[model samples]
Every structure is written in C-alpha cells, then in structure tokens.
Target: MKLKSGCFLQHLHLLLKYTACMSVRNAAALMEHFQLLDVHRKNYLNDLQFYCFLCYVTDLNKDKIMLLFDLLDRNVRGRICFNEFYTVVYTLLSHENDLEKQFIPRHAGRAFQLLDVDRDNMIDFNEFEAKRFLFNIQKEVKKIFKDIGISGDEQLNYREFKIFAVFCIDKQQKEEGDHE
Candidate 1:
C-alpha cells in the first residue's frame, strides 16, 4: 500500500501511544500489549497468534479472520509485524456505525487511497485487480460491474468505489453466512 508521506504511520503511532493515556511514558505500552503475544520474542506474530488477537477485537468468523491474516501477510512470510497488525485492526474496527455497510467515507477513502497507487483518484480494473485479494475478485470481474449496474466507463471514482466496496463486503458476508 502506498502510505504517501508516512502521515498514516505518524497518526497510528500517536493513536496507539495515547489510547492508554495522554502521557508519553505510556508510549511503549500499546506495543507491549502486542508483544505479550510474541511468546517466542521473534518480533512478529505467527498466523495462530494473529488469529488469537483478531478473536478479541472482531466479531468476524474464523474464515474471515484467516482471510484477513492472509491479506495482511502480503509477503506470504507467515508472519506479520506490529504495523501490519495495526493497519488491519484499525481498518476493521475504526468506522462509524451509521455507515457500517458502506464503511463510511473515511474508511473507504483510506482504502481507496491505498488501492489508488498511482494517485489518479480513480480505480481502473488494473488497480482493482492489484488489490483483488481484498475484494475477493478472483473471477467474474466484469460481472461485478454488471451486478452493480455500472455501465459505460469501467473505472470507478470515489463514489463508485464506495459502492464497489459495499458490494464486495455484502457479497462476502452473504457467502459466509450461506456456508454457515
């Protein structure tokens, strides 16, 4: 993901540091909580350890949790750093309840920014394909636009991207529910 000027990292650092208290002395405390799960002290969490953390923070099922782990472990290294974990957790947990289905503008904007690697403010099929894992767009790529009735130009602006994100989330949730 293109984090641009590292602003996200700075904000995340402050977020983790201050969630406990306003004091800088508690800066290391949030990271320490994540480290507690690093029983081997490898400075990273394995899939099992990652899943354990997800279980506490999200109501998502085991399948969804594993899918997220795989996404976060983009390098397929079988391990994830604190930053990766924080990114996934923040995306999953930080959003307004009123826009839960659509993920709210701020959440969708963050995601759009990540996917819009070229900073075009638009998501073409290639950009969409690059993050296919997030949307689970393994096949029927064209069908997605068809289902959403987005004709003419295939590229998605922020508004259309929000619709696409909601479409994918709803479809995945429904599919998961069916499996249950």
Candidate 2:
C-alpha cells in the first residue's frame, strides 16, 4: 500500500522479534504457529491460524482481531498473506512514523488531544492507534514513540508529544529524504 519506503525490512525484523517473544518461536515455529503445515503453505496464515495468531498477541480480543482481519483482507480473500499480515502487524503494533499518511495538521495541541484518547493525560500505543490517522505510515509507530519521549518515558505527556510533532517526525522525514 505504498507505506514508508525503507520501513519494510526494519519492521519485518522487529515483527519477527516480537513474534519470538510471544512464544519462543523461530522461522519454522512461526510457520507452524500460523499452521503452515496444516495448510501446506509457505508463509500464509489461514482463517483458523489467523484467529490463533490474533489470540497470541498481547491485549487483543476477538472483536478487534476480526475488525483488523476484515480491514486487511483488502480483496475480500479468505486468507491473509504474510505481507498482508506484516502490514497489519506493523500498523497495529509498530510505533514508528513513515509518513504514508501525509498531512498531520500542524496544530500540536489538537493532535495531542486526539491521540490521548483515554484522556489519561498521556499518550500510549493504544491511544495512538485510536486516532491512527495522525501517523498512517509504515510500522514506525514504536520509533515515533521513542523519538518523541526525550526522557524515555513509557508514555508521553502533551509536551513530549508536541516535541515529536514539531521536530521528530519532520527530522525523520528529512533524514529519510537525505538517504534517498
């Protein structure tokens, strides 16, 4: 879907790491986790395996998984390919910003409020995804979270989020542009 250009490999690596942590699974285990053996597939997960994988993720429920599955099945196909799975995982889990959804309003205050969905005065991943329109790029959501939090806080207050909006993402884009 034309997400950030250089993010595919990095996000794929990170997603692999996350999967390993879920249950000590390696490449072969990953295939088995998605039940590749059952379906005689190389990298795709079938409908049942999709449900299992969703249950494997942290803090996820059936309803949310269904919603995500429906969205990722862009062509209404019954199965989710590995690439599609990666994109969905990246979207749901990664915290980096790739600028795929260009046009974050320059208004940092409103942006902060929108991202702070729980109204807990801080921004966490869940809240970030709620207003995901803010950074609809590749799987850089985690990186964005880290870059914005100067003090390395697990969550960010409005001030930190502002710094992220004002400087971090712009700098990131500029740096990416330079590399290209």
lDDT of each: 0.59, 0.53
TM-score of each: 0.48, 0.37
lDDT of 2 at 162: 64
lDDT of 1 by residue, 1-180 (tens): 112243322233223312411134333554776789799899899999988776665455678677667656767799988877655644433331112353334457757766776677777877777565443334446568545536557778888878877776577657768999
> Taking the tens digit of each residue's C-alpha lDDT, what string does model 2 give over 2-120?
23444322333233332322223333444444454246555566667777655655345667566556555655677677656644444433333343223233334545654565568
lDDT of 2: 0.53
What number of clashing residue pairs does each candidate have, in the order they appear? 0, 8
Q: Highest TM-score, which number?
A: 1
Best candidate according to lDDT: 1
